[model samples]
Target: MPEKEITRISKFLSLVLRHQPEKINITLDENGWTDVATLIQQVNKSGSRLSFEILDFVVANNNKKRFAFNPDKTKIRAHQGHSVEIKLGYPPQTPPAVLYHGTSEKNLASILAEGIQKRNRHQVHLSPDKSTALTVGQRHGKPVILQVDAAAMHAAGLVFYLSENQVWLTGLVHAEFLHVLTT
Candidate 1:
């Protein structure tokens, strides 16, 4: 398929898999896994054409590695970023000394005072590197990157989970553990 088509399908998949599966009349299991056949059927039935071949291509070629298939290729799920209530079942992992979070410059003041909160999503999304954080921030507005003291947070009894896509996950980062890296 063409790149544009792939991108469109990928976004739609993210929407369904991460945020609104009901829109397509499919349901993700407790661990967020959904039957691949059901997903394709539901997607097509929803008036957005999807085939196994296209789904496979999208899963394989997604730039961020946002989705994954089961060992037998019969099931699929988003790696993370679920807005709906679903247990991702990621085990707590040791993160690096520091992680990064990207956001709009406009939010810096409030963030400096209030710390990073998960808001609507399951957890505060973090990046393993500044570049990735910058990209994430740019999506909102003028990018701002914040350095997180992950080691310190972990030492303080906070837990972290690294998603399959390599995005870090944590409950929240208090202002004490955050350092403004770029405005």
Candidate 2:
């Protein structure tokens, strides 16, 4: 795909699935999912009309498995962030400590690699307590937390911890840790 087209799709996915839609001033649904009609309207309002074909093509070609057509294929939802449904897709033997998310913005299958090991997008080294975890999730959109192997994250050098009232950092785990703890 052309670089511009790729960037457009990336932005589309970001706004649709990621909570960072505010970065572009596009407000998504409370659940962060917007129907196809609504999305088309948004596009039209932007002085760009995205046809159904283009929308389907973009959704199909998106790397992240963030967007999904509803069961009836009528509405679409960005299945990003926290999901109440328990994805027992992982093996029962696996311990809970680190959760994996697809950083891909192209293929959704890459986001779900059953059985095989995976990596996290931002290895958030949060306090190992529920209250703290919930507190850390505050101010930001509520994030889903699947049990992950904390030991693996620590071993792979992808763990970052935030102080009691701070949780803003974007870099390698070490830099993020310093920034969060120091600030």
Q: Pick the candidate with the highest lDDT.
A: 1
Each prediction's whole-model lDDT (CA): 0.93, 0.42
> Against the true structure, what is each candidate's TM-score?
0.96, 0.41
Residue-level lDDT tens digits of model 2 in 1-183 = 555785586566555445454433455555444566666666676676577777677667764434666566556655433222212121212223543221222222332333212234322333344444444344345433233344564566643343212321112322221111111
Tell me the tens digit of each residue's lDDT in model 1 across 1-183: 788988899999999999999998999999889999999999888888888998999999998899999999999999888898899999999999999999999999999999999988899999999999999999999999999999999999999999999999999999999998845
Query: Lowest summed lDDT over 10 consecutive residues: which window, candidate 2?
Result: 174-183
Model 2 CA deviation exceeding 4 Å by range: 1-3, 20-30, 81-148, 151-183
At residue 166, candidate 1 shows an lDDT of 95
Q: Backbone clash tally for model 2?
A: 11
